[model samples]
Target: MQNSTCHLQPSLATSVALPVIYSLLFPAGSFGNILAAWIFLKQAPTKRTQYIYLGNLVAANLCVCSTMPFLAVYFARGYQWTYVSTECKITNHLGTLNMHVSMYVTIIILCSTAINQYATLKKTSDTQYSQAINENFYRCVLKKFRQPKFAKQLSTIIWLTVLCITVIAIIYNAKEEIEKDSKCYSIGAEANETTAGIAAFVGTACFFLSFTTVLLSYYCLTKHLSKIQKTTCIGEKHLIYSTVKRNILVIQMILTVCFLPYHIFRPIFYVLLTDRYCLRLNYLVEIKNFLTCLAAAKSSLDPIIILMLDKTFKKSLYGLFTKSTPENHQCKADIFTEETSKM
Candidate 1:
């Protein structure tokens, strides 16, 4: 099976559309991630460890975006990869790595934030049940893991673990034989049914895990916030409540827009392709390709989300673009610094 070749031809419309989409995404994603990186770097020293994870997320997005031009050219050339086999392998590997990294990192950020918020709320609760066994259990669990240092360590561990698993997959795929006449265009062509099946299984697991984590985190957060609102006067903490709500909403939007479609479609696409059912459903291939491109576009879209949701980032961006007096610039910088410090 590893010696066999799989020739999957994308539809003409899809072939044309993919390159155009990739072409547009390349510059937009690159610019946004670069700007995000610059902002994160400037604020890194004063920022919490959450910013460390965010900085890593921006870096991963940049890595994903960097491969877009090559993909564009590949699709533009009628699904033919003009590059050497090694380059083809590297490009494919990078895409897979970035996909997993981006999804998992986003999960980590959301889960950590949810946990911290829950811990903070619980610690300040005046309810009689605050001293109950369940409350103590949560306090103990959260106390063990809820710290900036722990977040930093977890981020490092996630990066290393993802790198290791992806590297193994890359090596396995690289060992597969390629036909001399075939272009390195179809990812399914690089591996056999067994490998593709395993990949599909892993992807399915990841999708469920990520989706469930995000959903539960947001649900718990919303529930907790509702309780707080019921107990406390809305006018007293309106700014903080609104800001937190906006951030959560932005996260849900990002998860829905950028990640959800790909996660939902990818496993099905892979299963069909591996089982040879996709030949009868050629449109699925096109949809899969479109989802792949869309997933990559998420990295680009994230910075825009951050800019819209984060006042500090928005202010810094505005100050950068607009001509301002040194005094005004200094004031904005101070504000930015203060905001990041609180983050």
Candidate 2:
């Protein structure tokens, strides 16, 4: 009998590793996000801006997770296009939409949080200002949509924007053969170098700008609170400031550590890797693949970060999964509520 052992291409080796990791990750991410959305939905019945932002994020995560099965299959088949033509078309569109939507949604989330932080500091120098500001913002934006005046016009505009962008990206990807079987196919080389440069610049600007805004907001809030004469908010302000800062920092840390390497520096390495694609740069390709995978893995870890940051999520988890029956449920809720308040 022939020997079973054989060396594998870097791409094949990466493919071999994908399904095993993604199979575990996809379900966990899906379930956690579903659970978080359910809890958040139950708490606030109003359609507020924060709710809209978070709802979109949850929906984005769901869309991405839904694509994982097809992606898993792709890796399982060693990147072969095995689906029917129609199925291929659907998968291609869905996958591209999910990837782009997920990235932009994350950027928007970071930007929204930073803006909220700045607004909170500016309005009343109080964290509770978020509730009113967010509610008012949503009411203002959505009230027009509900009116009989131009509802259909606005709806059509929204849909048209989404449709145009989706179609353009699909066409761009198709023309570029971006999904071709290659060691670097997953990073999504743009249809043109100028387009890629623009995307990289925009994405990098949003990433750093959001991060710096959050950091500066935290510093200003701390400084303002220190100089304030009011003693009523001494304890409450400290608690809220500390908790929100920690939460933002956690997200910033993940984005900085996970994405910075792959998205920012990969172009420099990409040029070098191209010089010796056949033999010498194989190791570089392996590192690139691993970093890209790490970037994807951050999406899975986001829900866990939320849970760590929000005591409400932990309470819901304990209620749903633990032995907190009717007898102890009230106690559990109280405990978690107190923890959240302290946070």
Candidate 3:
């Protein structure tokens, strides 16, 4: 006879573990995201094209974090949800929507940054091939595509597309009945095999697409930087190289730590569950849950990443946190002046 404890152990561990994790995540994520939003709003005048995408990213993370407390409550009660079915469906839908939005927006920002860097490097270099390309190409392609207005338009399009898909998901999930004492779970009850499989496939596809784009962007940027290092003076090379490298490092860190693990495991778990192979693969299920938690942690980590990477955001955040004085106020003005000069 199979031991019932063996059958129940994973659920027991999940029920005990996730609530504790979510509890810590909720406050931390909330504070970080709120601060990010506030800083971005205050500094919107000085914002560049990437900052628009980043602001949207912050909003997406904030939306995701807002739902975490409810998730913690659901997990804390041994996966049983006393909330209405509508609430459960909305929470689940919002989570999915924001995940996609965050990944896509990050990819957009990386691509934009890569293109700008490449253009700058090519223009400054003495390479014959780069100069052979006419001004028309630069004006029609790079300049047109990389404009700040285009980024705002792209942001609008992304939100609209996400909203359309989320509405579809919400409607699809709403058809199912939630039993009176049902557990508000992601897999077994809320989503059945077909829905879960579709979700996993979509998630896997998005992950690959975004991951490939980001990888290629960073590769090209690195290659360009290497060429620049060889050609440019050492004094000028260090500052530019360090800045690009830091940005690339932060992007790669977010992808590896938050997004990669979840996408890798999510599809496997769903396919196994759909085929009724999950009984023998309980360990993978636990791993998938852990990855999901990591994905959620991205909301908290993103604000810190912004502060680390953006001088303006860091200065603004520092000003907000520290005591105000004439010297500090003057320092802030100086930073703003320096940033404007760069633009």
Each candidate's lDDT (Cα)? 0.64, 0.54, 0.63
Minimal lDDT window, size 10, model 2: 1-10
Q: Give the TM-score comparing model 1 with the true structure, all chains together.
A: 0.82
lDDT by residue (tens digit), candidate 2, 287-334: 755665666666677677767866655666667666756767677657
Better of 2 and 3 by TM-score: 3
| Count of residue pairs whose backbone atoms collide, per candidate | 0, 0, 0
Candidate 3 whole-model C-alpha lDDT, 0 to 1 = 0.63
RMSD of each: 3.8, 8.1, 4.5
Compose the digit string of candidate 3's lDDT tens values, residues 1-343. Answer: 1111222234765677887887898899889989889887885443465567678778877766876776565555534443256555555555444554554555445455545444444433434564445456653454443457876887788778767776776686677564455445534443356666686687678767766766765786678777767786647546655675567666766777788878877766655654434455556656766777787888777888788888888888878878989998788778777654343
Please give the TM-score that candidate 2 achieves against the real structure: 0.67
TM-score for each model: 0.82, 0.67, 0.80
Model 1: ten consecutive residues of lowest lDDT: 117-126
